[model samples]
Target chain A: MPSAPAGTLYRGREGMWSWVAHRVTGVLIFFFLLVHVLDTALVRVSPEAYNAVIGTYQTPIMGLGEIGLVAAIVFHAFNGVRIILVDFWAKGPKYQRTMLWVVVGLFVVTMAGFLPRQLMHVFGGN
Target chain B: MAATVPDLAAPRDPYARRKTTRSNYELYGWIFMRASGALLIVLIFAHLWVNLVSGEGVNAIDFGFVGGKWANPVWQVWDLVMLWLAMIHGTNGVRTIINDYAERDRTRLVLKLFLYLAFTVVVVLGTLVIFTFDPCPTDAAADLLPSFCSSLPG
Candidate 1:
């Protein structure tokens, strides 16, 4: 028999990269969720307290940050479905690479739909 | 002529244990991730639509806006479910990451300890906030309260 290959099975492939993105986004979302809950909890303290914090989120910088946050969440959500299909569908293994492209396409369409409206909200005075 | 069939089920070593020592805990965790992930996609997408995409978008979110939404039972329950499911799902995801990266036993244990602790605190605090929230606190300025608050009888 021939000698085995030197490199790893998943080196720099789409599957590996998507897996990395999923983990990174998942961790980022988790941290955001923790802080989100805490910020919402400020409602218990007082309206002023809550408003003071939430007001910051409405600023231009944070509005941009919200875009990034939503981008991460959207990618994670789509990729998560791709993962589920890969696990459960009969032909999933055969088509995982194709599915990644589909996920990217959907991500682009989604961001396209979201960006304009959100941009107006952020930059449109009042 | 009589035909004899051998017992295919018989173990080669009679003294050896037949069953595996493995439990289904990890299997169940794996399934939970997929199931919860599917549900969270819907829950959170709708959540984003309402909170960030509709009407005034992010600019509309404030104490009064939150108070208005939580005033209804539907929103209260919606948020409660979202809070619980998201926390559990996120905690479990992080736990998996910790297991993968943290090679040392002590390191894994300590990391998971904090993970679980944060999960419990966030879940409990979020649940309480949703259920026990007073949309119209009398002490707060009227301007900060939802418009409907002023109409309610004290």
Candidate 2:
């Protein structure tokens, strides 16, 4: 039997990191969707309850949180499509890393397009 | 004294790990994931655009706003589809994670039990809310009703 090293840093490649990020974002989006469902369900309880619940989300802090939620969604969706391509396409695995970089580039561009308008909604003087 | 005997009833194939004979379920799930992801992009972005990007943005999301949107069958269906697809997709993703990480059968069972329960609750409640929502209930206590409810001609 071979003895294992005391401390082994398993440095994973881009594919591994993308897998990790996919799982993380997936879980984050899961919980967020749960809360969103419950809050949206407030409409059934009473208008007061619904309005009050939604009103809490209008704060600047929640605005930032919404940005994070959107980021999670964009990453998960983009990576999810990449995963599908990898699973089904003939040349997918060979260019998986390139696909990951493409996902990241799209994520950055989408967020840049989204952030200014979102920040203005949050911080622009009304 | 009874002799201790080694158990020999188990299957001899050490590599045999209860493989699924049904391949179509997974194939369908994979297809569903991509199909739903594509649709969700449109549904979610349109939802955000209507609710937060247009008009007064997030602040416009109130009882009246939601009521007005739900008053239309189109928005109601859009929201219903979004709720179902997102919940199902997320639940399946987590189920995959649980299967990968949970070493013990009992642990996997318990975790998925709870996951399914939560999924059921969200889907059922969300669907019911979308379909059955009454923005202006005549029977509601006047104090609990939205201010606009009083103005509508009965």
Candidate 3:
């Protein structure tokens, strides 16, 4: 039992969610990798055919899709780095708490860097 | 009866038994896994539905389909975000796995160096493709150009 008591944040649950995300992202990224590789192979299949296939990616709806994908990737990468630290360094536990904020800081910086253009597209600004 | 074995007390250094100095890295890492993961859940599902399940379904995807998506700046940014996120996520996740398995200090360093290198290559190339993709390329020359290109007034 946690000494922190109920009604407050559940510490264990937080860790559980992280583990689950790590696994789930693994599977999803693998699936996407397959499709991406196959699509790239189309380049050898003649220019017309390849161009046609790539063209659909330009659609607005799909544009949003891309945003969602990149976001998943960035988050997974940053958090993954954090996990690596914990496993190797014996001192990992000492900084585990503060590292959460670092990851968030990175996440925010990443999103801020890209959001302007992303929102511009949705709003039809550029 | 179990075989009896000799028990010995190992000498311990004072420093070895002392609580390690703090760094809070684990706390952050643990938090990141859950938070990013929660977000990935929505992003990942939305991705699948649009690409594989929406109107015309998977068959609807093709070169022209992709070109169309990127023509809109929306997708350019979307892809940019997804690429950044997944790459970071996968890289970080792998880093975790690496630390867990690789014991030697030198080995860990070498492996991470490679991982980051691969991450950089993929991210840079993917971003370039997203931003530079051309839908209506006529550079193949008029003879080899798509019929649609020929019909458009120059």
Candidate 3 per-residue lDDT, tens place, A54-117, comes to: 5565467766766676666666667666666766668866776566668768978977765555
Please give each candidate's TM-score.
0.91, 0.83, 0.50
Q: Which candidate model has the greater lDDT, 2 or 3? A: 2
Poorest lDDT segment (10 consecutive residues) of candidate 1 chain B: B1-10
* Per-residue C-alpha lDDT of model 3 across residues B1-154, encoded as one tens digit per residue: 3567566456563445557698888888666665665565466556655764455444456555565566678767876776676667667777887786687789999999988887787777777777666555655544434345556776
C-alpha root-mean-square deviation, candidate 2: 8.7
Best-performing candidate as measured by TM-score: 1
Q: Write the per-residue lDDT of candidate 1 for residues B61-114, one digit (tens) a residue.
A: 998999999988888888888898899899999999999878779999999999
Q: Listing candidates in order, what is each one's chain A TM-score?
A: 0.91, 0.90, 0.77
Instruction: List candidate 2 stretches off by more than 4 Å.
Output: A1-11, B1-23, B139-151
lDDT tens readout by residue for model 1, A1-126: 434547756767788999999999999999999999999999999999999999999999999988889999999999999999999999998898899999999999999999998899999965
Q: Assess the local accuracy of residue A65 in candidate 2 as a C-alpha lDDT between 0 and 100.
A: 92
What's the distance in Å from true for residue A126, model 1? 2.6
Q: Please give, for residues A15-111, the per-residue lDDT of candidate 2 as tens digits.
A: 8899899999999999999999999899888877887889788889998998998899889888888987888898999989999999999999989
Query: Candidate 2 DockQ category?
Result: medium
lDDT, candidate 2, B17-80, per-residue tens: 6887766887788788888988988898788788767776787787778877887899989999
Candidate DockQ scores, in order: 0.60, 0.54, 0.08
Winning candidate number (DockQ): 1
lDDT at position B144, candidate 2:
57
